[model samples]
Target: MNIIQQKKDERTRVVYIHIPFCTNKCFYCDFNSYVLKDQPVMDYLRALDREMEMTVQAQPPGSISSIFVGGGTPTVLKPDEMQFFLNSVRKHFPDWDENIEFSMEANPGTTDLEKLSVMREGGVNRVSFGVQAFQNELLSGIGRIHNTDDVYRSLENARAAGFQNMSIDLMFGLPNQTVDMLSESVTKALELGLPHYSIYSLKVEENTLFHTMYQKNQLPLPDEEDELNMYLLLMNRMSEAGYRQYEISNFSKPGYESRHNMAYWLNEDYYGLGAGAHGYIGRQRHVNVKGVNPYIEAVNQGLPRLNTLDIPREEAMEDFLMVGLRVLDGISRARFEQQFGASMDQTFAAPLEKLVHAGLLDTTDEGYKLSSKGILFGNDVFGEFIGSLTGN
Candidate 1:
């Protein structure tokens, strides 16, 4: 902690707000969200406002650099609800950076011109639509309500509403999905020439309909080779098309990277507001109550946090390595040293040496980054640092 380092530490905060209501939940999804029908929508918004007030009162906030509204499909909110929710955000966290990257996660078919117009006026400068895939069959099989037409209409509506910094999500591995199918999806996605794309392999997390089918050997997922090919194809395609693989699953044109996600990869402190949202600040992290009713009730009493934990220094170091490496540019040695007040070389010498020796990690003049091969086998590369210091 020298004077200059202290001066540099005054970085702005990132904000994540969760709206856990969806018109419908996709089968492969396990996010903390519920069906929108008959829910106490207005009550939840008010509860969210109260939670935000309490949160700022406790720790306060610096100028907000990014605000990402995610989950269940934030655009599912009606025009009026959207206005109130956005108003709550401005009321509590008014200090916005002039160039703040305010992003809202939208689902196709859930947004119309009117809804999007409300969002743009509410300080949202970016919108990411979850298109998942271009083919109608894959979308239907996955229980998504939106079709290819809906995706087009949604993007057109967003653009019509004065949005240019938009992004879309595409999925790779899924039941009965082929390499050709994925290739087709990629082709269609790139054709739009959007500023950003986030393509991910399916993980079939527990508690999802897909997970249940997997248990019964009913989930006909793509074979490993096909999945590998899909990943490789996307990497090559995005690169050739002039998009940077900013992070493992995300691609964007120069300067179009999602700043909110960058905050997570850098393991920086961010305010996570709303039900089931997670926030980390100063080595302490809190998860809000997951259920909408439970969250609203909790907020009426006080902060709606389900639990808060002080992240141990060793675990935090491991996390720093895990998340930072996801970025193509990798982590910085100076950052590690400044945050932990220790040399990265001395802290995890053996693991670093091992990974670099295996060609999974490469040493940069400033720090370390994943090698070209390391990108494909990222899970394995990250695994090496999981317990570098702590036995677990």
Candidate 2:
């Protein structure tokens, strides 16, 4: 069956809106974003509003449990622009869960008290700041426009604006990052006493400045041993600071886990709107047009989709294993059977046994999960589940 027919009755519970404009692009980043210069900003917002309006008319949503406005720095929008965008969201997806988690990604230097007030009044309850490092040299090296002072000032303003539920992102494997440098960054992040933190290793993705530097040996990144030590140090420190490692790279204090991101790791269906956004519904995945003008024009005509394809059963099973295993609690056997109508052991017995014997996966009462050792080599463990089902 085609994607539309299959997903016609599916009720999307999570909504992700992309605002693909940033103050400046980071060196190691490769997401679909453009500099906030000479672009038709209001025109893009109007195009997004039209997309949301048409989306709900086609496949109406249930009580939305989570709404995440991620970006190229969503806070780059002016107060009035933010107001218009949020109003459009409320106009379409009006029915929200009582305890909905509304989150927007902000850059350290972009957010201010006035814009934050607009966000809070518009129903945003959570704000995540992209404060990649606390060191000024590291910040400049990464091509980030914000410095350490902006980080402190932004957090202060966020708190002043009544935003208590906040999180900050940090990076570990940078060009000149060492174990001690990561420790200092972690110390500063914990000192803020926020509810959640997301620290990720820097990957030199293609088409980025960092990738080109790496190819020429200009990027003086930490070696494998140093990077491993850095990861271990941060993990130990976060645990010591009383944060739960709910996912591989996310830590939260008790009830502050990001529900919007958890929805993705749990493989739930969500609406992805705006230019260059991707959405998954029923058993199909689709990506919207990447170019801003092209997307706006397309949505004016109809849905601004570039391509949509149905995910095959085998590929879906592999995805379930791959994404589900990223969570600390791991995949559940009963839920797997409910989703695919087959026993987990029956489908993946060979690889499961292999990983179990290798001490990479431990069998739980409900299902299987990564061992402490397995978390470090997660790619290898996830790879075991990929082609094994087809072989059997």
Candidate 3:
């Protein structure tokens, strides 16, 4: 069925806007993004505006609980461009929940006071800075143009612009990064006293410079043991600092958890707009056209959807288990029955029993959750559920 002609579901409460332009690409990064130089920025924004108009008219969202503008570097947009883009959003998603969490991803060097002021006035309440590491050498080593000073300056500017609910992304296990270096970075991050922090281990995905370097034995990533140690050390540090490990890689002060991301972890439907974005609605998941010009041209006629697939009930059940287990609280048994119309235990007794016997999973009153030992070996636990239902 044509995606546009398909019946619209009003369950979507989260909106994700993807800005595909970046100042430069990082070596270890593989997200869908383009360098900003000589690109048709305004045309892309117009395309996005058209997509928003067509989308809400088709499906009209439920009261939007959260709006996340992520990307190549959302803050890289000029102030006027930001205004136009934000105005387009306000036009379509006029009614929002009282406590809407509007967040935008920014790079340290790209956000200045004026651009931040534009964001603030446009109703962006949260700012997430991509401050990958605090060390200048490591920053350069990872192909980041921003330095330590830019991180400090960006935070100061964000605060001056009246953003309190802010988060900074930190990465560990980089090339030539040491435990002490990571410790220092964590100390500096904690000292900021921000509401949220996301520290992720580096993954060398295909098509990235890091992957090519890895293939050539040129990337100097930490060994498996050191990487594991790094993860353990950060988990302990964040706990000691009074931050809750709400998800495996996310820590937050009480009540400051990222609601938009939580919607994702809970496997809820959301609107994904802009080039190369993915969306889930009803039972179908869709990916938008990837290339900039192609996406813009496609949306000019209709939706820019490149492909759509209806997720089978078993696959959705597997996805629910895999994604929900990322949260510390785990999935709820009642919610699973409500969503899939089957008992969780009845659906996959074999995998659940195996995981429980291996001490990788434990039962809660609400449902089953990952055990303390299971947290470190999460992929193994999630793997147990995949293909277990269909025996494929």
Model 2 ranges off by over 4 Å = 1-10, 390-392
**What's each prediction's TM-score?**
0.97, 0.96, 0.97
Candidate number of the best lDDT = 3
Report the Cα RMSD per candidate.
Answer: 2.1, 3.3, 3.5
lDDT tens digits, residue span 142-258, model 1: 999889999999999999999999999999998888988888998999999899999999999999999999999999988899899999999998999999998999999999999
lDDT of 1: 0.92
lDDT of each: 0.92, 0.91, 0.93
| TM-score for predicted model 1 compared with the true structure | 0.97
Candidate 3 TM-score versus the reference: 0.97
Quickly count the clashes in candidate 1: 0
Off by over 4 Å in 1: 1-12
lDDT by residue (40-138, candidate 2, tens digit) is: 889999999999988888878988899999989899999999999999999999988899999999999899999999999999999999998889999
Q: In model 3, which regions exceed 4 Å deviation?
A: 1-10
Candidate 2 TM-score, true structure as reference: 0.96
